[model samples]
Target: MLDRRKILTIGGVAGAASVMPLARLAHGDSTENGVRNATSHHHHGGKVTTRSVAANAAPPLDPFSVPMPVPQVLRPSYRTSKLDQYVLDIQPANVEIFPGFKTAALTYGGTFVGPTILATEGRAIQIKYRNRLKEDANVHLHGGHNPASSDGHPMDVIPAGGSKVYTYPNRQPGATLWYHDHVHHLEAEHVFRGLHGFYLLKGYDEARLNLPSGEYDVPIMLRYGKFDEDGQILFSPYDDVSTRTTFLVNGRPQPYFKVAARRYRFRLLNASNHGDFKVNLGGREMVQIASDGGLLPAPVSRKEVLITPGERAEVVVDFSDVPVGSSVVLESEWGPVMRFDVDRRGFDTGGPPAVLRPNPTLPKPTVEREIRMQLSDDQQVFWINGKPFDPDRVDVRIKRGTTEVWRIYNDDSDWGIDHNFHLHMVRFRVLDRDGAPPWPGESGLKDTVSVPPGTSVRVQATFGEHLGRFVYHCHMMEHSGPFQMMAQMEIVQ
Candidate 1:
C-alpha cells in the first residue's frame, strides 16, 4: 500500500518547463541582510498519505445544520515595504476580481493575499521577508508563536531574489493569524500561486473585547483559485482533482462589499488552499461569537458556518432586517462568494454580545481517546497511519493535560485526496459524524478539520495542555506542506 515508485518527490510545477520548483529545492538567493547562497537541498522529495480506519456504519447522531447570518466588515489595511522581492519568473499583473474567467491571482505583494501584518502582543516583528515569486520563498506564520528559527522551517528558503528578516517576538494573545509559503515542495504551488497574508495579533484582550471597532471590524480573507487562460497563475499537483471554480473574499473575485445596516463584525478566515468552507448567509443570520482561541461564552446564531482551512471564525452579523437595498451574501462551498450591500444608509440597533470575552469552552472531558482516520491512495504512498510522512520520526505523543478521543477517517476513495487535519496546541470537540452528535451548532471548539474523502470523523480533545512541540498537519496546503501530510504533538512534561 506504499510504493508508487517510492513516492516523495517534492517541488513541482514543471507545467512546461515553467520551473520554480521551490527554486530548485532551496538553493539560495538570500535576503534580509545575510546569507547569500547556501543551496543545501537534502530533504529527499516528499510523500506521505496513508489510510486505515474501517469501522463504518456509526454515522448520524445529529449532523446536519447550516445557517449563518452574522455579517460585518471593515478592518483591513496593508501597504508596507522595503522592496527587492522576486521569487523567480515573478507574476502578478493587476486584478480586483471577475474579468474573463481565470480570475486574477499572482501574489507576493499585489494582494491575492500578502499584506496585513499588524502586531503588538509581545512586539518584535522585524520582517524583511522578500521573495518576489518565480520560486523559493518562505514566510510561514499560520498560528505564529514564533521560534524554530522564526518558524517557516520546512526546507526554509528565501532564494530567488532572496530576503529574510524574520524576527518574531509576539508570543500569543491577539489572534487571526496567517502568512503562507512554507516552502518544502513548493507549498501547494506557492499557496495556489498567491502566497498569502493577514497576521493581525494585537493584544489587551482584543482591545477589551468591545467587539466591533473601527469601521465595524472586517477581515474576510477566504480563498480558492484555479485560473489559466492566459492569466498566468495556475498551479495544482498534489493530486489535482480541481474543485475550485473561483472564489476569493479579501483578494476579491466575487467581491462586492458596501454594508451599513449596522452591527457588522466578521473576522472569518478560511484561507482555502484546498477548499472546505461551508459558510452560509445568503439569507442572513450569523452570530457565532469567536473561535480559534478567542471570545465566545454566548452568542451562537448560525445559518451556516463550517470554516476549515487553518480555521478561524468570529461572526456578528445583524443587518437590522434589511431594507436599504437588500443584498447580503457571503457563502462558500461554491455558491455566491461575497456580497454585503445593505445600503439604505445609517442604522445601529445593537444585538451582538450576550457575552464573548475569552471563552475557549471547557467542561466535558473525564478522559477520552478515539482516532479512526482513514484515507487511501495506493500507488503514491499517501497515508496517516498506513505510513508516509517520516521527518526522521516521531509519530504521536501526549501527556501534558491528557484528554483524548480523536477519531477521523476519510477513506480516500481511490484518489480523492483533499485533507486538512491540523491540531497543534489543541482545540477539539466534534464528537460524531458517522455516529451522530454534533449540532449545538457543532458543539463549538475546533482547531482544524475538513476530512472529506470517504468520511468517518470523530473527535474529543485534551492534549497535554500545551507544553510546546505541536502540529497535526494536512491542511492541504499542498498535502500539508511538502505533501508529506504532517503529524506531531509532543507535549510531554
Candidate 2:
C-alpha cells in the first residue's frame, strides 16, 4: 500500500496548543495517553549481513526449503474475520540476535515480522482472522494469487472482537509475499500496530532457478517500528500520524549476523508502512537478480535499488574477500539497516547463474490506454480521477493474458500528495519515467511504484489468465478509504 494517512493541518487558532484536549473520538481502544492508528515504521540500522565470512565457508539456509527436522511445522490453513474492534496495542519489543543489539519491532507473534505461510500455487488459502483491538481492521495479502473474496476488499471491516476468513485459491508461481491489515478507516493504525506477516508461494519453476540451494538463499523482511519512553511500543495516532524516525531490518532495531565469507542470496522485502528505501550495501553495490514476480532474465548489477512499501527484490552479494572481524553494513539513503559480521570460517560458494528464468514478455499493448491519477485534498476527502471509490462501479476490465500500459500521472497540483500505485495480478515493467527509460533498479517487474508529487510513470504488464475480480489502487492506506482513492479491475475469460 502507498498513500499513507494524510495529516490535516489547522492554522491560525489562538493558543490552540494550550487548549485542553478535545474529546478524543472513540476509535476502538485507544490508550488513555491518546494514541492514533498509524502505519508501522519501515526500517533502521544497516543492510543485512547474509554474506559469507570467507571464500570457502558453509552457506546459509535456504528459506524455500522446509527442513525435515522441523517437518511438523504448521501447513497453510484457511480462516476469516469481520471488522469489530479498535485501538489494538502491538508491542515492538526486543529480542536476542547473538552478538547484535536487541531488535525492536511491532509484532503480533512477538517478532519483528511474522512467520511465513508456505503454500503451493493453485490451491485455496482460508484465513479466519480476529481483531482484538478497539477499532475496525482487515488484511490484504501483499501478492497472494487469489480471488476477490480473499483480497481484503477495501472497507470490509473486521470489527474489534470480530473475525473473517479469507478464502482464495493460490494460482501464481513461487514468490515471497506478505499479508497485513487493510482496514479502510484505520489501516495506518492497525498495520503500524503490527498486524502483518509473510506469505510464500512455492512452485516448480522456482526449483529450476538454480541460483542457490539447500542452504544458500534466505527471505529477509525489512520493517521499522517505534517505542515509547515507557518501554512500550509507540504507535501513530490519527492526530500525530507520520513516519517514525528509526529503521529496522527483519524486525530488529540494530542487529548483526555472522557469516562464513561466501556468496549468499537474499530475498529483500520492503514491508515498511510508508517509506521509500534505496537499499545499498554500505559502500558496495548489489547484483539484483529478481523482483516481485520472480527471477529476471539475468542479474542486473546496480549500486542501489529503491524499494517502496510492498515491493520485493532478489539479490546476490559476495562476501568472500572481507577479512574476519570486518563488518559490512546494509544501508539505505534513509538510514542504516543491519550489519554482516564476517567470521574466520570460509567455504567455496557457487557463482551467480548466467541464465535465470525470465517472465515471458507479451507483445506491447494493442489497446493503448492512459490513467491520470490525482492525489487531491478537500476538507477531508481524497480521490482518484477526481472521484471517490464506489464499490458499485467496476473501474477497469481486460481479457486474460492481454498486455497494456498504465500511465499514472500524479496530479498533486492542488495537494501534491505522494502516492504509491499498486496493481494486482501480473507484475509490471516500468517502461519509462517522464518518457525516458528507467534506471536499472527501476527497470525490473514490480507490483507497486511510488508516483511522487507532480511526476508521472508508465508500467507495462499483462493480466492474470484467470477470470475474476481483482483490484489496482493507491497503496496508501489512509488515502484509500470508502468512496475515495481506489478502483477495481475485472479479468474476463
Candidate 3:
C-alpha cells in the first residue's frame, strides 16, 4: 500500500543547489533539491506549506528533494480598457504529485493547484470558464463581492461541455482571496480532485507602498492529503481529517523553497477540506500584514499562525537577518514539511509597514441572528439551524446597508470536530469568541471564522448593497455539501 511514507520524503541533508531554467523558475522553479538560483528579483522559493500529523511515518524518498511549486498566474487572453478577460478549460489531467508517479486529477488549465488569477482592485475581471470535465461544474470566486449571477450560487452550474462567464468588479481592497468549485453536493469531491486556485485582488494604489510587489509577493496554497497505492488522491471526506498524515506543499510532499535574503510577503491559503494548519518558520518571528479581507490596519507579530480551512493569512518575513547559506525549516503540527534556504543576496526595498490598508466602516448593527451548527444524530447530515441547505429557502433576510451581528455556535460536542463558518458576498470583523474578546491573532476582517466545538463566535458586518441571495455555512466542504450544512440569505433593499 502507498502509505504516507511512500509519497513524502521529509527533511534533507544541507547543501547548496544549482540554478534551473528561467522559465521553470518563473513558474515555481522546482529545482530538485535546495533552492535554485533565479536570474532576476525572483527567488527559487514559492509560496507554500503543508499539513499532516503522522510523526512515525518513514519515507521512501529524501526530504526536500523537489522544489516548491508556485502556481503560475494565468495571463489574460485579451485585455480591454474596462476589464481583463481570460479563459479556463476545466478538464481532467494526470498530475505528477509524487516522484515517478502520476496522480489522476482535474485541473484548470492542466495543473493540480489550478492556475492563479491576479486582478487589479477596481478593475473588472471576466473569466470564461469552459467545463470539459465529465460532470457539471461551476466557478465560485470565494470571498468575491460579485453580482448574484456570477457568485457561483450552489444551484447555478455549467453542464459538461458548457461554459459561462463570471465577472468580478474587484472594487474592494487588496486581499488574499481564492476561487474553487462550488457545485452543490460534489464540491468536496471536485475540490479534493483539484478544482481550486488563488485569485489575488491587488490594490491599484499599493504601488506607492512598494510592499514586496512582483515575484516577492507569493501565494502559497497549503493542504493535507491521503493517497492510494497508485499515488492517486483518496477521496474521503467522512474520514477523520487527522487520518490524512501526508503534508503536501502545493501538491508536492516535503519540498524545498529557496528564498532571497530580503524580506518577502507570503500569502498563505489553507485550501484543505477539513484540516486546519498551524505553520511557523522554526520560531522566527513573522509579521502578519493581511487576512481574508485584505491588509490589516496594523501588523500583528506572532510566533505561529493557525489557519482553518478556507481562511487566509498574509505574513512578511525578513530573511536578511538570517545567515545567507543557512536554511530554516517550516515546521507544522506534524513537524517540518518544507525548507526555506537563503540562496542569494537579495535587495531589500520594503520595510515593516507602519499602517497597511484601512478597514471599511460598516453601519451600526440593526439585526442580530444566532446560528447553530450541528450534525444530525446519525452524523449522516450536517445542518445549520437544524435544517439542511435549501436554495429556495431564505434562512436570513437582512436589509441592505444595515449591519448585523451573528453569534455562530458549534453544537457538536459528541462529534467534537473543528468547524468553520464562511459567508459569501461580504466580509466582517470577528468581535468575540465564546463571549470573550477575540484573540490578537484574529484581528483582520475575514469571511471565514473558525468555531471549535462548544464555542461561539460573534461577528459583525454590513450587508452588501447588491440585492440578491447568497449563502453562509460551515466551510467544511463535506459538511456544507452532501451533508447540507449551508443556508441561504437575501440582501433586501
lDDT per residue (tens digit) for residues 1-493 in model 2 = 2233223211000011100011011113211111112322211122211211111111121211111111011333323342212122233446432123443444544544655566666555565665555667677888765666667766566777787776646666566677777766566656755567766666666665556644556677765444544334555433222224334455444456666677777778876555545678866757887777666667888778877677888888888889888978776543446667787666754666777666565577856666666644544455666666676777787888788888888775344345678886667888888887775655556788777667789888877656766667776554564325677778887
lDDT of 2: 0.57
lDDT per residue as tens, model 3, 137-190: 998888898998999998899999999999899988888889999999989899
The lowest-lDDT stretch of 10 consecutive residues in candidate 3 is: 10-19
The 0-to-1 C-alpha lDDT of every candidate, in the order given, reads 0.56, 0.57, 0.76
Query: Tens digits of per-residue lDDT for model 1 on 1-493?
Result: 4343113212111111111222133332221111011222322246422222111121111111112222221132222342211221234546434344344555655655665666667655566656665567787777665555666765657787767776666655566677777766677776776777667666666654556766777767776554444434455464321224345566545556777777777788877665456668865688887666545556788888877677788788877777888877665433456667777566654565565554455555655444333333444434576665665566676776667776777555343334557665545767787787654444555667666556666877766323545556777565555456665556677
User: RMSD for each model, in Å, please?
Assistant: 22.3, 11.9, 10.3
lDDT of 3 at 377: 55
Candidates ranked by lDDT:
3, 2, 1
TM-score of each: 0.32, 0.74, 0.87
In order of TM-score, best first, we have: 3, 2, 1
lDDT top scorer: 3
